[model samples]
Target chain A: MMGLRLILEQVSHAYRDLSVLDGITLTAAPGEVLVLVGPSGCGKSTLLGIMGGMLAATGGTVSVTGEVAADCLNPLTYVFQDFALLPWRSVAGNIDLVLRARLPKAERQARIAEVLALTNLTEFAGAWPRQLSGGMRQRVGIARALAVRPACLLMDEPLSALDAQTRDLLLDEFAAIIARAGTTTVYVTHNLKEAVRLGHQIVVLSRRPGRIRATVRIDRALTDRTARDPDLLVIGEELWRMIRDDAAAAERERVDAPA
Target chain B: MPRLEGPVHFRAAGFAPKDRAWASAATLLGLLAMWQASASFGLIKSLFLPPPVAIATALWHLTVSGELWKHLSASLMRLFVGWTLGTVFGVGMGLAVGLWSALRSPGMAIVAALFPIPKIALVPLFIIWFGIGEGSKIATLAFGVFFPTVIATAGGVDNVARGLIRMGQSFGLSTGAIVRGIILPGALPAILSGFRVTTSIAIVLLVAAEMIGAERGIGAFVLSAGNLYDTDNLLAGIVVLSVLGLIVAWIIGRLERALLSWR
Candidate 1:
């Protein structure tokens, strides 16, 4: 499955008196991993939501430039921060849910099996979500998104919930999964190491009333780097230096503001 | 004498039932023994408190003559018809109120106003409306069961996590698909719990409705037996009601296990 090109042109969004995003223009090319990184109050998530059509920008155009393939199961899908899996559904059941409406019975079964294998959730196919570890549950979440053969996948801090060790382990697994799926993705996170490691193109946003700060391009192939790859770790540091001022300002604002 | 002490004395799995049947039987037998002693010793008047044996004897006689079946069949029939009607309509109205924005406010307002008023008191009004027959008796039970079911169903739907619904939308699931796949199963645990409460309410209202005017129900038999001073039959009828409640609870327990196995 190929990806869809998502374009945002001079987009602005506001919630009453508060402006969240402003004059932002970016393009996520087909099959590219565009990582959005910023401080806590930045509109990285809000932008991802707009791209996925979960939210609308208050001003300007957010458009998909490519036609969705007629055979594609879903044109776009969001992977939520909390995983958002139905607890009642087993891992296979969760993956099958997206395909149930459109696919033939045989195709649905095949797609569920394929995604389970791809996400390393084949062993957990019949296990309920409650029975899985946190990282495994998120694998089901990713598998569910991929079962659709979506053109674009939007993810919002999908690993923010795991402990440090799990997060470290799962980061490599996630990179491999996304690399194999080849779906255009807009990933949002505050973790700089994650940004530089997975991002083909990194778009940094400033704190509240978020606008583009810097756009960094990573030339390294995902297969060439492990989590401890020196070049990848250097880019992670570079990403931190770019956003450290905004993050520090946001922190001080939190300390100064009334509860 | 040696006493078991420390962790070895207690069962390793605290929740595991250990000789539960024996414990239950011993407690019941002890209670029956105490009751018989009181009656034989004349601590309480036999007229006021019939011994367990007298009650058991009356139950045996009623069962042999089919008198127990006569009262029991009528009450069960009413319960089946009334509870079925109430549950069907209650679930329908509940889904409508939960899913449709237009029905939500007005339907909730009507339910809130009607829910708290004693449904047993409405039996006299129902009798006047539907006559002193099975119609009035059934209406009382249906009315009593409907409100709570609606409240439970709507609350359950409300409590389904927002993220799951959003996930459904993200997957491009239709509204009907989302309701059937996500919302209904998500709400089942709460709705089944509501059934436990509604079944109890249904039984109580059934008894109250039967007491007022019904001729062939346990409630009516107990009231008439009291009037005739047949304490044995009266106690026998009360025991039947207790067993009916226990059966209803057991059915709900089985249903919860079957439907909510994931929980």
Candidate 2:
């Protein structure tokens, strides 16, 4: 799974007059996970969107500056927060939805089979999205993204919607999958634990009209990092400290602001 | 509070309702039996309200004489042709309105303007335009079915999740593929339920158009029977229409089940 290097140059966005993101410059090195963490309403998801070319930055440019693999169907693919699965489609069918346009019948079927196996969803290939638990549904979402064999994966809080136990369970699975694929990933989440678990480099942003606050790098291999590690815990604590006051301020602002 | 002791009452019980097919059949059968008893006892005049047995006898004669098939065939043809035409054009226009910014406002404006003008009231005008032939009858049904379909289909398309569409776009699905695979299936439940309303509307208009002009439909048969004061035949014709409604509803039920098994 060869990956692309994503470069963002002073990217900023505003929804009409209300500015959201400001001069957010970052680079996701090839085959690495770059996690964006911030308080709510910080436009981390919007930044990810711009990086994926799903949304154009209002002020600056985002570009991919590396070779895409020959088998890559989508150079930039997203695994959305809400799962964004087609309810009418079966687990295998949902993955096939993206492959149908690019591959022929036999290859599409084989690709579906491969991704289903990758996500451990092969047994439930015929199951509909609505029939699966939230965790399982998001697994299917990841599998669908993987089926395209993307050059880069843009994941937007893909585990945030699950119950805490499911979130923990799937977090490990996600780390394993991402490491195996080695796709350049720009993952956005509010959970520092997830950021610590998956990210090679973590970027923290201040509250709304988000600006980069801190960048933390973990040299530890993704597979070697564990929740109980003293260094990882310290890094997590430092990140919490960085955003704690801003998170509080953002919360109070929301509660007191006029609708 | 002693940990709020004693068994917790089943407070969440009984909001869900279950369907009983036997109960429905029994209800209809019970009503018919009572009606037959009333007629047998001379409590009601048969001339005013024919007994179920008399109506069944009339139906049996109509069947034997092959009169029922002729009327049934004509009505079925008009219903099929009119409904297919309306659904095809309505869905096409609906997709156009739902997908493109250029067509949305103008299409909705035209729909809103024409939709509320009750289609039954336009039968006379249609007859003048299309002539007092199959053209006018079919046109009446087709027109009656069109507007509601447009509204249902457009609403369906509108309600498809924006996130799903964006997901398709992010995956680089072609515009045509997105519309066919994502948008169509997403909107189908609404479109199918719309079919329920449009089909009934088509039937209603079918009868109205036939009553006004056609010489060989169930509506015409019922009208002529009423003119001759033949209560049994009139009731028989009404029975056929009711049965037709039930059959159409049943077919749609099967279609919904087949298409929406995922739900």
The candidate that achieves the highest DockQ relative to the unseen native structure: 2
Instruction: Assign candidate 2 its CAPRI class.
Output: high
Q: Which candidate should be chosen as best, given TM-score against the real structure?
A: 2
What local lDDT does model 2 show for residue B110? 94
lDDT of residue A95 for candidate 1: 83
Cand. 2 Cα-lDDT: 0.92
The residue pairs found clashing in candidate 1 are none
Candidate 2 per-residue lDDT, tens place, B26-120, comes to 99999999999999999999999999999999999999999999998999999999999999989988888999999999999999999888887
lDDT of 2 by residue, A1-259 (tens): 3569999989999999989999988899998999999998999999988888789889998888888888999999999999999999999899999999789999999989999898889999999999899999999999999999999999999999999999999999998999889899999999999999999999999999999999999987789977677888899999999999999999998999999
DockQ of the two-chain complex in candidate 1: 0.69
DockQ of each model vs. true complex: 0.69, 0.86
lDDT at position A127, candidate 1: 98
TM-score of 1: 0.93
Q: Which sections of candidate 1 miss by over 4 Å? A: A255-259, B1-29
- What tens-digit string does per-residue lDDT give for candidate 1 at B89-120? 88888878877889999999999999999998
Q: Write the per-residue lDDT of candidate 1 for residues A1-259, one digit (tens) a residue.
A: 3458999999989998999999999999988889999998888888887887778889989888676766687788888889998888888988888888798999999989888888888888999889999998888888888888788889899999888888888889888888877778889998988887789999999998899999999877676668888888888898899899999998897789899
